[model samples]
Target: MRLFSLRTLLVCTALASCLGMVGAQAATKAQPAPKPSGQKVAMLGGKFAFTLPKDYVKGPMEEIDAKARAAGVTGSLYMNKPAKRVVIITETPLPNDQKVGANDKPTLDGIIADTLQQQQSSYKDFKKLGEKKIVRKGLGMRQLDISGSVDGGRVLSTTITAAYGKRTAMVNVISLAKDAKAHAEVVKGVTGGK
Candidate 1:
C-alpha cells in the first residue's frame, strides 16, 4: 500500500490549482485581437489623403456605375468597401445630355434620393444624424451622416456623403458591426482634411 502525507497532498493540490489558473489566463492572452473590418473609405482630394481603419477595405465602384446608368447620368464615381466593410458613396452632378434635371449644384435631398434609388432601398432604413458644414484648408464643404444595415445582418454600413462643386462624391464606410463613434471620426478625417 502507498500512502501520501497530508502536507504532500496539500502542496500538490495547491500546485495543480495554480497551474490551472495560469493555464486559463495564458489561453486568454494567446487569443488574437479582433481584426478591423477592412472596409474601403475615401479621402478628400486635396493636399493630403486620409483613410479608414485597417479593418476596412474598399468595395467595388460598380454600384456607382450602375447608378449612373440607371439615372441616365454621366460622369459619376462610386467606391465601395469590401464585404462587411464600411463604404463611402459619392455622386456628382455634371452636364449630361441624358439627364433631364437642371440644378446648378447638388442638393442634399437630391443626392440622398438618388442613393436610395441606386441602392434599391428605401430611405426609411437610414437614421439621419443631421448635417454640418466642414471647412478644410480654407475649402468650405458640407457632409451628411447616414447609417443602416444590409444583406440580412451580414453587412452594416455608415455612409458619409460629401459634395464638391458640380461633382458629388460619397464614401460609404461599412462593417459587420455598428460603430457610430468610429464612423464620426472617419467623417471628420475625410471632411476636415479635404
Candidate 2:
C-alpha cells in the first residue's frame, strides 16, 4: 500500500519556502482564527473561499497544520477516499517590505518556474502535460498539469496559483493518472468552472 502523501508532494512543489513564511506569520498573529462556515472554507481573512466537495472528507486543521509544520509548508487538506485524490489549499503572504504591482507577472512567473523545476526533480518520469493562464472569479491564475510515476503507478498533479492583494493562494490536486479526466472534472466542479 503505497500512499502518495500530498504533504510530501507539496513540500517538493516549491511551496515550502512560501509556506515557511506563512507558518512564521501564523505563530505571531494575535487574533483568533475563523472557522469555516458550512461547506465553504475561508482563507486569507475571507478574501478567498473554497467550496468543499460533497463527498470528500475534510481533515481537522490541527492535523493539517501539524503536517504542514512537519513538511515546512502551509495548507488545508481535503481528501476523497474512493477517488484516491487530495486537494490542498495553501495561502502565503507576499513580502510586506516590497511594493508589489497589481497582477505581478514576474513574481508569479518565478514561482511557477520554481514549482516546475521542483516537480521535475521530485518525481520519476515527470512530464509536463499542459499549462495555461486563466481567470477565476476575476483573479488571474496560472494552472499547471503534471504527470509522473509514483510507487509504480502514474499520478497526475494539477496546481493552480492566484495572487490576491498581499497573499497568494495555491490549490493543488493529486490523483492517479488513470483518473486524469475525472480529476479535471472534479477541479472544475469545485472551482465552479464550466
Candidate 3:
C-alpha cells in the first residue's frame, strides 16, 4: 500500500495558517549546509517543533494549501524540500467531541487502520512496507512506511502519527523509491527519531 497520500496527508494538520510567509521565503533562498545542526524549530506557537535537515527549504504555504485542497484535505502544511526528498508536517485538532486517553491503543489502531483503508482505495499500487508502534518521550506514536507508483513514478513514503489529547500530528516524508534511503536521516530529524 502506498504509505501516504500526500494530498490526504496534507489536510491532517491545522497549522497551515501558522506558517509564516517570510520564513518560507527565507528558507528557499538560504543555502543550507551539508549537515544541518538538527535544531528544532518551534511551530504553532510552541505546540510542537521540527528539525529540518540542512539544505532543505520550506515551501510556500499558499502553494501547499492549494495542492492540499485539490486533494481534499485542508490543514496547515509545512513542507521542506531538499534536492531529492520532501518532508511535510501537518497538525489538526481532533473533533471537539473526541477524547483519546493516553493509553488508548485500540483507538489509535483504529485510526491507523482507517488511514490504511483510505490509501488502499485511493492508490493503484499501494503496498504496506512496514509499521511499528513505539513510545517517544512518553507519547504513544505509530510509524508506517509504504510504497506505490504515483504519476507514473515509484515513490516511498514514511509517516509518523502522534495523538495528544484532542490534537494529532502527522509527519510525512516522500522520496523516489531509489533515493528513500538517502533521505532517512532527514525523516528521522523531522519525526523525532531515536
Candidate 4:
C-alpha cells in the first residue's frame, strides 16, 4: 500500500477548478472519460460509496484520470449544471515514506498549506475564508474554505481531506459565491454536520 501525494490531490479537484472557471484554463488535457449514468458512486472496490445529489450527474467521468495516472490518482466527478455546482472525489495511494498518520499534525498542516497555495494560484482573486479540523463518522478530517474568481464569477469551495490506511481521499465542493448557502449545505452534508 502507498500514500497520496500533492499532485494526486490536485488532479482530484482540477475539474472543479477548470469547470468553475468555465474553462478559463485547462488544468489537464485529459481526454474525456465515459459519463457515469447514475448518481451513486462506489470506489475502492465498494469500500467507499457515496450517493451524490440528484442534479449532480457524473462528469467526463473516469475510473482513473490519465493525467493523474502516474500519481496513482483515481476519481469521480459530479456536476450540477442548473446550479453550477461541482463535487469531486479523489483517491490516491501515497508512498510509504510519505504516509500520513492520524495524529500527524505537521503533515496535515503541510497538506493544507499546499492545497491552499494551489487553489490560490489556480483561482484569481483568491481568499482564504476559513478552515478547521473535524471528525466525521470516526474519521479525522481537515476542512478548508476559500473563495476565488473564475470565469468572471466568484466561486466558493470547501475541501475535506482524510487519510484512510495508505490512501487519502479528498472531496471538494464548489459553487458560485451567490450560492454559498447551498454550497455550505452541500459541504455540511458530506461532513455529516447537522
Task: Flag the better candidate by lDDT, 1 or 2.
Answer: 2
**For model 3, how does the per-residue alpha-carbon lDDT over 7-104 read when each residue is reduced to its tens digit?**
35353221222222222443333323325454456533344466665455555444345554553333333344433456666655444446665545
lDDT of 4 at 191: 65
Over the stretch 18-109, how does candidate 1's per-residue lDDT look in tens digits?
Answer: 23443344322222222333433443343223444564433344333454546532222222222222343444443343232222134545
How well does candidate 3 match the true structure, expressed as C-alpha RMSD?
Answer: 8.0
**Whole-structure CA lDDT of model 2:** 0.60
* 30-103 per-residue lDDT for model 4 (tens digits): 22222333366654344344556666767654545566667777776777766667787877774453665554
Top candidate on TM-score is 4
Candidate maximizing lDDT:
4
Backbone clash numbers for all candidates listed: 29, 0, 10, 5
**TM-score on alpha carbons, each prediction:** 0.46, 0.70, 0.68, 0.73
The 10-residue segment of model 2 with minimum total lDDT is 29-38
Cα lDDT computed for each candidate against the true fold: 0.38, 0.60, 0.55, 0.65
The residue pairs that clash in candidate 3, if any, are: 1-126, 1-127, 1-128, 2-126, 2-127, 13-90, 13-91, 14-91, 15-76, 16-76
Off by over 4 Å in 1: 1-49, 64-83, 89-125, 151-158
Regions of model 2 farther than 4 Å from truth: 1-38, 60-73, 95-102
Q: Sort the predicted structures by TM-score, highest score first.
A: 4, 2, 3, 1
**Backbone clashes in model 2:** 0
Clashing residue pairs, backbone N/CA/C < 3 A, model 2 = none
